[model samples]
Target: MACLSLDLCVGVLLLIGLRCQSCAGSKVYSSPGASVALPCGTRVHGPCSKISWKYKEKFFFFRDLVESGKVIDMKMGRLRVGADCSLHISDVSFMDGGQYMCYDGATSANTTLQLLNNGADEVFAVVGESVTLLCSDSTSPGVGESLRWSWQKKELITANQGGDVTVSANGKKTEFKINPDSSLAIKAVTAAHSGYYECSLFNDSGLISIRRRILLHTLHETTDLPSAPQQDVNFTLTCSLTCAAACDEDINLTWSHSSGEQQQGGAVVKINNTLISQLLVPKSQASQTSTCVVLREGAEIANHKWPVQGGKEVMYSTCSVCYPRFLTS
Candidate 1:
């Protein structure tokens, strides 16, 4: 029993050592203009094992023995390696997108590379308005070849059809023109003009990409009606009211005199209990101009022009009668 227990312990220790060695190296695939890191360790019984990097079956770096330092590939001079075997690639390109591998003799790992176009895709335009679509690549000002922009509308039968759109970027300014493409300018935007728009680039390598659906809306202007009447005197001057939708409640009513004095009157009731409001004036004050304003939830929504006594239903006019002050004789 003692011998069996000792053998079990040894087997467990051996399995742990194997797992640790396997965890020492890792592989990652990334797009061009992106960064990648390598893993390293000093787990082996004989000093730290050297780390090596590769791309597309090419040797990118081999560790230095004397200096114990990292190295980069001459072809990809921009790549950087740290003491810990991590790798970094800045401002990646389509060409740089690919497979990568890391190896430490007995241990090796591999990853596939993928390149992405970091370009703008969608263009938004209002109905009946003109729009321009732009497509570009992740290139610095003076580094890579200029990007060519092209657009296609899904409605077109073929990419080579007439009126196809094309554009080229000078630095950051993209100039647009039409070709067999339909994405350039729709003479006048309409309901039929709303659809999917795709923008792609044409470079040395033929790659086509697209941006998904964008919505266009047509906006219209509307007018609101005048508010209900507030205060009035003798009902000489009348108030007017208007609203976008029909009003429900009885509009509050009041009266005011030409001298700017206000008085409470009977609540103005809607004729036929309809939204329209009307208030009768005392015959004596019929000639005095008065204002009619509507109130809803303590807020004014509409107001008719101040009604004139014996005058046309205009906004403002002169008042005829002035209320006399009572004097004790």
Candidate 2:
């Protein structure tokens, strides 16, 4: 009896598959928090008196115009059916990806919905600094025992999958290393490397589970100071750090003096797609020197130093401007 039941189940599935093949397949692309309508059958088929929509063969909606319209097992209440037998879903999510079937009378149609996330998190890193791009499935954080991770930059030209299979273009893989957490750690970030980075998750059978992207911006800092200075003068020293885009971490700027004077605090920090830090100091009788330190994640990334112009003339032309009067004159 058990064998007979198994055969019957297979027969039913085969029949459903054949019915689905009668209608051409459709594909829809959408992101989370968006709404999409999946057409089950073209208008060639008149209004369906009896319509049903199923997800992977699991009933989701059933409507018999003459009988009744009823929602089935799914807890998500954001699904509805159009008079044309099309299924409309609102506030779609990652879990909503897969095959969907719309049954109208004796004819069945299928639609394959592809869910993509385009609003990737942005990251900014200084040139020559190391950075890690993150990708994860927080909505459905299911990591299979044999789960595999793949990393790609920009295009599919370079792909790394669990160290089992890798594709690179002329040693392009030398710059990036993948971590167990599916994060891509770049050894040294450069302007040439600024682009969209993607991470894909897979199962043991190499089936793609999820795909995400991260926008990385490689930044460079430039500092400007007045060429001429007078002693006991106040001037503004500006450091400009520019990137292709904005990042999550705020760029930290600190000012330090070489005169062994206690480093003063407070710098005006402004951020957008670019970061700017300004430091104001009083020029001393002797040429005082100060440096602007740019830090990210508590590590120094870039610095610029300038000699503050002093009122006193050098006793000798070759004297160091930033040195003390006793040592120079």
Candidate 3:
């Protein structure tokens, strides 16, 4: 996402019948899927009509939420005007986080809504394959602070302020290792190792750690036929996706063959908070590699390639295979 000079406007939101004097500026931090009320930052006194709200999204895109004391259409009723003329936002998302400006016709107030959540990351690996749950830092490390990593709320490792690190001996210790950069590296991950991993750093401001959650999933492939497809037999490679948590956006899965043939599934249904997509590729010709591409909002997020013939599978994340290590069977 590019952050340039703000000249963009989606539409106008108009709110009416609210009076304010002078609201103050504020900063609010919320997680994904929460409700928050952004004060117009105005102090009340006499008649201060014609209040409006504007927001600058994370990508520098500007949105007009209110215009002249009336609420416009945005988020489909998720945004509402409080009795006090504050902007009440429900079902907050990572995409909804940004800077906001409120104007009460005379005085204007500014606010910043910061969303505290993990990057939308999900790793797909075969069972028994070694994988690394990367903890990328966007903030510079401060002195006299520790970086801690946990899985399902259990603290498994810690990197002290002096940079010395230690892994716990809590039975699962042997299965995990802490890398020099503090990223959690698992020796060999089975199906049981699949879950959410959290890395956090605390400062006076709060959890400055940008990456708080990482999804790890072990894939178990099933074949329609008992044995592999031969020259005459047709092989259908099933490409699937399983959401480890609540999917924040619409995820679309597509199967791309080395032959340049691409097929995308329609209407990715969410069942039990998990999403699954499948495709069948017939091994008619000399099949080399079949790639599974995951897209959110029409952009590719992850690309996993496997041999339609026979070899190890590879998964590539954002910025050219962010998964730095590959394991052998």
TM-score of each: 0.25, 0.38, 0.47
What ordering of candidates by lDDT runs from best to worst?
3, 2, 1
Preferred candidate (lDDT higher): 1 or 3: 3
**Best prediction by lDDT:** 3
lDDT value, candidate 2, whole model = 0.52
Candidate 2 similarity to native, TM-score: 0.38
24-100 in candidate 3: lDDT tens per residue?
A: 46666666865667766665333324777888654435577877666785667888776567677877788878778
Which digits, one per residue and each the tens of the lDDT, describe model 2 over residues 252-292? 66767776453564554556655566666665523666665
**Local accuracy by lDDT, each model:** 0.36, 0.52, 0.58
Model 1 alpha-carbon drift over 4 Å, by segment: 1-32, 36-49, 58-69, 118-329
Error of 2 at 294 (Å): 11
lDDT of 1: 0.36
Q: What local lDDT score does residue 196 receive in model 3, on the 0 to 100 scale?
A: 70
Question: In candidate 2, how many Å is residue 214 off?
Answer: 11
The digit string of per-residue lDDT tens for model 1 on 197-313 reads 434332222221222222221111111222433344333333322211233464443444455665454455453322233445554554564444344464433232344444234
- Candidate 1 lDDT trough over 10 residues, lowest sum: 320-329
